[model samples]
Target: MPDSPKEEVDETGGPDLISFADMPDRLEAAGLTRISKQRCRQLAEEDPAWPVPLDKALKVGRMRLFDWRVLEPYFRNRTPRQGQRTDLKPPATEA
Candidate 1:
């Protein structure tokens, strides 16, 4: 079966280098809603910060492409896992 134009192909199974300037329209047209273009640009810019907000990413530059897996969680709004709390430390592991 032929794929529809609305669906993007990532048979490469990896992230593709993408430009932030063009990412807004491509992402929008693909039906992927994001926090904002500015935030998208922040990811494009590879900022060194955790929990980057949408509006503060305007100072970014166009950069590389990323994989669907890499970006999926950002666009997909999900609920927090059950029985989880940040106040507690993760279970220690021995290797």
Candidate 2:
């Protein structure tokens, strides 16, 4: 089957732009990280390394589209946050 409009690459020969709503599933389906829409939003808002959205200034809708090219690497190389590690032992208290 032919690709849909949503799947077409842009003139820059880059991957199709995607919204946060579909990003998590798309990345997960591609064997990347298992992320949520809320996490995507948080990363976009808090992560300095996040790619700038192509339509950041457009206020017409709540949809913010990002470039897949940049995001793919980000997700592929993402490491777990330090606070998420479970191997650390609690500090001993001196009596």
Q: What's the TM-score of every candidate structure?
A: 0.37, 0.63
List model 1 lDDT by residue over 1-95, tens digit each: 98867535556644443445565666676576534567665554564432334343333354344444445555454332345577798877999
Query: Cα deviation of 13 in candidate 2 (Å)?
Result: 4.0
Cα lDDT tens digits for candidate 2, 5-51: 66346877865677888888889877887788998888888887776
Q: After superposition, how far is residue 49 of candidate 2 from its true place, in Å?
A: 1.2
Point out where model 1 deviates above 4 Å: 1-7, 11-14, 34-36, 43-62, 78-95
Model 2 steric clash pairs: none
Best by TM-score: 2
Q: State candidate 2's TM-score.
A: 0.63
Best by lDDT: 2
